[model samples]
Target: MTTVAFVLAGIAALIHVYIFRLESLAWTDPKTRAVFGTTAETAEVTKPLAYNQGFYNLFLAIIAVIGIAVGAFGSASSDDVSTALIHAACGSMVAAALVLATSDSSKLRGAVIQGVAPALAILALLLS
Candidate 1:
């Protein structure tokens, strides 16, 4: 269960890192615009906001990755801290997805994409 949790969290972290790239590095790119369903003008106008939001995603992913690493390789004394980090990071991801899904019905698919792996990781961690 612990391994499963770490693997799922790793996947969620990777997904967020990809999201960060799309949002921060390529927000105005045609492909990214298409993925986000945004017009060029809107993308341009929202670029700053997206850039900042992308960092938030990146930070969450970092926290999860760090937690996975600590849990896997850190000293026994650090186990509780690693667990807390994982829960905090993945919980934030799930909460953000829930907010997005509730705020806009059309974004449900995106919400699921954003949330599922982290949610599963949390569940597996609990079972572990």
Candidate 2:
């Protein structure tokens, strides 16, 4: 049970890191910018929003990574704290998925698949 939990949470954290990398690193490149469906003008226009959102995601991912590490490796005394932090991360992920879905329905399919998967993951952890 413990190993399963750690593996799942660690994968989630790593995925978050990958997402942050996509948002922060990839979008900066002119070539990758096109993949984001942004023209040069639009990219410049939404630069601040993109930058802020990327930063927020980076911090969120870092928190999630810490939570996973703590949950897996921290002492028994810190279990509750680690769980609480991961729960917070889960909540944030759900929120972010919703926001993405609503704003970019094409990218994430607003609350359908995107929201469902993470919600299920969080539920699994909670109910386990």
| Model 2 lDDT, residue 102, Cα | 76
Task: Report, for every candidate in turn, its global Cα lDDT versus the true structure.
Answer: 0.96, 0.65
- For all candidates, what are the clash counts? 0, 0
TM-score of each: 0.98, 0.77
Compose the digit string of candidate 2's lDDT tens values, residues 1-128: 44554555555565666555656666656875765667777777777777666677667657766777787788998878777776777678778788877787676743443345445556766766
Candidate 2 local lDDT, residue 95: 84
RMSD of each: 0.6, 2.7
Q: Residue 125 in candidate 2 has what lDDT?
A: 69
Worst lDDT run of 10 residues, candidate 1, spans 76-85
Say which candidate scores most in lDDT: 1
lDDT of 1 by residue, 1-128 (tens): 99999999999999999999999999999999998889999999999999999999999999999999999999989889889999999999999999999999988999999999999999999999
lDDT of 1: 0.96
